[model samples]
Target: LAKTTQPISMDSYEGQEVNITCSHNNIATNDYITWYQQFPSQGPRFIIQGYKTKVTNEVASLFIPADRKSSTLSLPRVSLSDTAVYYCLVVRYNQGGKLIFGQGTELSVKP
Candidate 1:
């Protein structure tokens, strides 16, 4: 299993761009990088995922370097409602693997 590390907390103002990065130095070849966001008392919601390159969705973008050791989740122009705890996960799908969640980075979006 690849151990992932991320910031403990982050702060940003409303309508500002926020980028949270995760480092997985021992990531495996078959492992795919995924990110999730959770509000207080709510389950984590999927934000984005990437294999090797950049992947962009309507809400956020995921950028992975060539080495696949790290990935970044970028939220464009975040609002006050975006304040939540963000989780970074490394998983191998189709293998019945359990999802292990680490202490996520708490993002505080202030107005």
Candidate 2:
């Protein structure tokens, strides 16, 4: 399993763009990068996923460097309601298609 590192917390204001990064130094060739957002009680909601380069959805954008060792999740024009815990996941297909989650980055979106 590839270990991931992320900031413990982050702060952002309303209408601002926020970027939370995660590092995976020992990533393998077959690993895919995924990101999820979790609220206080609700289950994690899928944000985006990418193997390389950039992948964007209506919710957020995910950027993966060419080295494939790190990724960044970008949220544009955030609002107070966007405050949540974001997770960086490493998905390995051969390993029973399991999703390995790490300590998430807590984002506080202020007004």
The best candidate by lDDT is 1
Candidate 2 lDDT over residue span 1-111, tens digit each = 789999999999999999999999998998899888899989999889899999999988999999999999999999999999999988898779787778799999988
lDDT of 1 by residue, 54-85 (tens): 99999999999999999999999999999999
What is the lDDT, from 0 to 100, of the residue 95 in candidate 2?
Answer: 79
> Candidate 2 overall Cα lDDT vs. reference?
0.92
For model 2, the superposed segments whose C-alpha errors exceed 4 Å read none
lDDT of each: 0.93, 0.92
Q: Distance from true position, residue 62, model 1, in Å?
A: 0.3
Clashes of 2: 0
For model 2, state the Cα shift of residue 20 in Å.
0.4
Q: Which ten residues in a row have the lowest lDDT in candidate 2?
A: 94-103
Top model by TM-score, which number?
A: 1
